[model samples]
Target: MRWFWIDHFVEFETGRTAAAVKNVSLAEEHLHDHFLGFAVMPSSLVIEGLAQTGGLLVGEHYQFNERVVLAKVSRASFHFMARPGDSLTYQATMQDINENGAMVAGTSHMGDRLQAEIDLVFAHLPSRENDERELFDPADFLAMLRLLRLYDVGRQSDGSPLTIPAHLLQAEQAMEAATDLN
Candidate 1:
């Protein structure tokens, strides 16, 4: 699956909140089909981006063990259009978290302008019990976590690196080297 949102974590507080950003560019292919003449980022994908950012935050809380998927979005709204050349910063705060699920609230801003806001709910499922193992794997999973820079910031509430496994790190380096060649 292509990652629709490639995020950079600016700050993360274990079980509390996280801030991230996505740089929208004209070079993206979807812009061509999203609109004929006036390209704009679709609202659905904007929500997806928010979901992705929030999902990672929620998932990390479980140490990548519990599978968390976006279960619902409530009162989601958009105020402005996001187009190429816009750098959208997304900030998500966890409202609640339990064994069953998590609730998060987020806002997307293009510079100082509010672009969108959402209240998202995510459900946690055990990986062993999940039927979509092919869709999620330890390798790609860790890569995504690294790509989001989830482990590159402050320690968790208990003071830990939120470490990524060594094997995953090696795999990520290989992937990065391969991409660099292209």
Candidate 2:
């Protein structure tokens, strides 16, 4: 929730796949300290970007109702270092998904060259009547989706524009009403 490894979603297909981009810039503080003179985007951050892209895709499948958490990284292989000024494209494909969790296969590329390949598993937290903890604020999550341009590029299997889930919209409206009351 604090650090967004991916800049935005460039492509998103409901219950299928998603692609995101991250522009590596010299202005990033983390890269500056990563090395004295050699600044490269860390592989860990790259994995995070892939996880985020895949996680969002999986979460959207269930209308953002499930608490999809990255459970494991089954595999990862880095081919080359991504330097500043490189635009990394992360693509995540749904390998398998169910009520319990989902599996995602991901790849990172700089232009046509493969930068990394990773496999991830996401676990959906159990919903309980007694438990009311929310992974994210509905308003904030909606805003994030908007900022990421998910709706701008996302599409359903039938090729229609991805509609915002009713639950998310209602929650956003409720938050707005509460804010107005304050």
Candidate-wise lDDT, in order: 0.80, 0.95
Q: In candidate 2, which residue ranges exceed 4 Å CA deviation?
A: none
lDDT of 2 by residue, 75-131 (tens): 999999999999999999999999999999999999999999999999999989999
Task: Kindly state the number of residue pairs that clash in model 2.
Answer: 0
RMSD of each: 4.3, 1.3
Instruction: Go through the candidates in order and give the clash count of each.
Output: 0, 0
Model 2 steric clash pairs: none
Instruction: Give the TM-score (vs. native) of candidate 2.
Output: 0.96
TM-score of 1: 0.82
Writing each residue's lDDT as its tens digit, candidate 1 over 1-182 gives: 56757458887878788888888888888887888999888788888888887887887777656778899998698998999888898888999998898999999998889999999999987556546553465667676676778888735777776666565667677877888999
Where model 1 places Cα greater than 4 Å from the true spot, the runs are 126-135, 158-160, 165-182
